[model samples]
Target chain A: MKTVIRSTTLADKLLFIALTTAAVAGIFYSREAMPKGSDVIIEVDGRTAYTLALDTDRVLSVPGPYGNTVVEIKGGRVRVKEAHCPNRLCEKQGWITRGAIVCLPNHIVISVGGKTENLPKGLDAVTG
Target chain B: MKAVKVLTVLLLLTATAVSCSNGPVEYRKTKPLMDTIVTITVVSESDRKADEAIESAFSVISRFSDKIDFFKHTSELSAVNRNAGIAAVTVSPETLGVIERALYIAKISGGAFDPTIGPEIRMWDFAKKVRPSDEEIRKNLPLVNYRDIVVDRSRSTVFLRKRGMLMDLGGIAKGYAADLALADLKKEGIAAGIVAAAGDIRAFGLKPGGEAWRVGIMNPRQKSKADELIATARLSNKAVSTSGDYERYFIENGRRYHHILDPKTGYPAAGCRSVTVISDDGIFADGFTTAVFVLGPEKGMRLVRDCGADALIIDRDGGVHTTPGLKKMVAFENGH
Candidate 1:
């Protein structure tokens, strides 16, 4: 069956599609400015070495060379669940969002969406 | 037009928050040149780039991997070993810097931290291993005066007064690199990270989880195991370095000859098996770690304190002597 469409309506539809695409692209490219309120917790080898909560402006640091891992907390899952460093794998594994973050080598994991990662990686481990 | 303006404003805000980005970026780096397996984690937002920059810097300063390292050559020191007695020779900038730091440590240790022990080290032959004659030791003893070896920073010059004198910075260079990397990371927009070069390390900043960097001081006696958790520090914009003899030493005729040699006597300093130096500057830790090995804990502690540096000395008897402000960092139950 043939469908009749108005020329003016078609032009409006095209403009709407273009505007929608531009808005989505703009948001995706400039995402860092989107006020990411999510936080994270780092567990190395099943040990909670860091409990990071991200909100405003902050940077963090923590030790490394960990392997073998276990993560806790719900909602935001901790990755890097296993490694070789006597359950100290959290240091070796990678970061984790509510979605994913894990390091197979060190079994390090950063849990996301569960807690706030306000501190840097190494602030709590060292005295400086 | 309003939406466009908002997007531009947001872009500017992210740019302003470049160093302020606390996004947990796991840092994993490896380098074959320094013979190190290094892994660093930072909230720099781009942990991948941080690792790349550090590795790149190591390549830039590597003496073992590049031809440019010849500029910082210790060949003159080797030349002294070849020519038992000659007038002082000029040295390169890199050599001069290492020697100057060694001399500084020497003065701090009050002769205990001498750098002119090159001849003595050659006699003992810990690096290669072939003991020299007693006559050779006597001859070299006169040559091992750190005070005699002079360095002129302005002119970038060094002179071995007694001729056969040599200066080795095996203690401090690695520490310097670690400090440099941490500093470099900050300069390169990585305000949070750590650098461990052959066990000489330093860390700065906190984890995204609001915790400090927990460095594990491996057991000198046991490679695979940690002796005890000597310390877990915040590194809060600081550097650290650890020197030990359990791995790099020679057991000759029931005697163990380690690399940490005293400049005055040409022998390994007695009193400690390992010395862990924690300082704001990696270079100081490097020079002081060896200085402590030469100076012993009492004088070493004094020298380190005078220099505004900190230390953790694991004594020959397996005791730990931590600095005044470092006692809290030393977790002996889980440290090396």
Candidate 2:
């Protein structure tokens, strides 16, 4: 009876180690596959005008109701380089790695990391 | 005995695998609507359901936009403006509902948040960078009174008592849109998500992992940096709106002029850099931000307390004043 009890205890210890190792490995792999900043999306008058890669550096002129607003993406960040709107609020809103740059008068919006899936889980939307 | 031990190990491994894959998946989409960016986020186990909810929410927003967009001549709001003082223009029930709410807030705020400030807004021409002459402003100031707006609930029509009294629903329209979008989502059986229109946001139900949604307030001083947050608030099942002087402003001759006008003075309201209000309704949150902003800190705090809402007002001197209830919910960022 003593020998049987010792064998059962040994089996329990081995099972515990095997389960924990597998769980840790699974968690590590999932974390490594998490999404990052991949795309920059620009919308004009609520319609998507551009979807470009973040790693690319370029400038594009987006025409709006008021006039043309220049959008610049550089070094994985995006911003409004110039705009014809009087206040220049969009241009003043500097580089954004995440979140959005909204030019209300011109009806243009530039969002970094286009989809919400690429962003963290807890943040649903940004408010002023 | 050996076979039973191996079975127990397999069962434990399978349980761990299930637990690891059980985290909620978040889905979000941004569409340009109502002259601003509208973002909707949903967390659920089913991707198909999230997509359906977002589609319905956007449709609701589009329907409201078609009714209230002041700039769009085809919109119902344009019809009302064109017939100002000539006749009562028939409108949809949605437009009637928003106008009624706007008038109610205008009465409560003593006309500080007037939807009839369209004539004045057009004169400023923020897009064109032109400031209207003082004479032009003086002539248009009298037309900026909310008391002049007449709403006929029985007929579902709206009328401006005076000619040239334009109804610009910029102040209150987004809130109404957010509220409607949230309602649409709920009807579609999506209980965990947020519907946000720029500065106006409405969050409902729990976030993933059963945590409250964390909302970051942008620092007015950090105008150039979009990610520089002044404070953060944890909330669930509520709406928040912020009106800041820094949002749309131009500097001329060392004087900074902003877009939020004081219906009384016909100039940009002073005393606060930004005012954020959180409440159960988006319309209230959006309208009150402008009202509290025009009222300044002392009067604003009084109104906030009376409404049973939470507020965080940043004065021009960079001092943060929050209501007692908001004090617990807000955590200031470093240097704030």
Candidate 3:
């Protein structure tokens, strides 16, 4: 009986140590694996029309009902380089490292960062 | 002793597993409607349910937009305009409700927000940067009056008293649409969501982790990236609408002419740069923002307080005025 009790104690301690290690590993893995500011996502008419890497330098021409809106991404920043809409307010918005640039007339949304469960930091929506 | 130790570990492990299974997943869908992008975000337990709810909400909003579009010749509001002084035009229940609400706001604001400003609005072309002559404004000013609108609730019809008077619902329709979409979402079993149409936004229920939705107000004079947001408000079960001169305007000879016309002057209101109103209902928030913009900061804040709503007004000289209840919720970017 004494020998059996010692072995049972050993098994319980082993199980406890194993579970603690697994929990710690999961926490580290989730933290490291999550991507931040991964890509520039441009949506046209409610669809993901373009997903460009933030590290690359590229200019994309997005077509809308009105005309094509030119988007330029460079040096970890993005902006609407030119727009065919009459207001040209999208072009005047300039560059942004985070948040979204919306062209209401053309129905285009250019945003930075990966889509997460929480709303984007600082700005979930902008009202003017 | 061994059983107790093993049971403790099993309980902790079960708790973590249960939490992971019940974690909320967010779904978002955006579409172009009412001349702006309408985005609906909902948190649900399953993707299929969220997709169906979002689709239904969008359909509801689309149907509402078709009825009240100011530019569409076949819209119900246009039908009422065409029949002005000729006869009453029967409209949908949704249209009647929105028109009734518009008249209420018009009365309370003392005609600062008149639905009959369509004739005056047509005079100025913001896209062409054309400023109408003072004589043209004077000719149209007489047609811009809220008293001219007549709604017969029993007959379910709308009539304008004057032959040339036109009813434009551009100010209040978007917010009403947002409210309708949210109601549809709730009917579909969505407990938490946000519906945003341009400057009109409505939020209900808590976000993930029980956090209130954070909404940022755009700076009227945003010259660069750093000045994007003037302030932010944490809101739940509330609606917010903002009217700004910078939204649709043209500058000629250092004079600015915006889309939100004053009924009395038949020209862009010059009192405030922007006005943001928060209320329990989206219709009031939307309609009152335009009314408050025309009323300026002092009178606007007073009217907002009277309506049991909150507001943040930015005057022409870059001064900020906020209602008492909203002072703590609004966090100014520059700590103003």
Which candidate gets the maximum TM-score versus the true structure? 2
Candidate 1, residues B188-269, lDDT tens digits: the string is: 6776666656456677776566656665453455432122234555455666766666534667888876767665656666
Off by over 4 Å in 3: A1-122, B1-21
Residue-level lDDT tens digits of model 3 in B202-240? 999988778887888878887655566789988889999
Q: Model 1: runs farther than 4 Å from truth?
A: A1-128, B1-22, B34-43, B63-95, B125-130, B223-234, B252-254, B334-336
Q: By descending TM-score, how would the candidates be arranged?
A: 2, 3, 1
Ordered list by DockQ, greatest first: 2, 3, 1
Task: Point out the higher-scoring one by lDDT: 1 or 2.
Answer: 2
Docking class for candidate 2: acceptable
Docking class of 3: acceptable
Candidate 2 yields a Cα-based lDDT of 0.81
Point out the worst 10-residue segment of candidate 1 chain A by lDDT.
Answer: A119-128
> Fraction of the real A/B interface contacts present in each candidate?
0.08, 0.39, 0.37
Cα TM-score of candidate 1: 0.60
lDDT of 2 by residue, B161-260 (tens): 8988999888989998999999999899887898888769998888877887787787887743334578888879899999988766677887767888
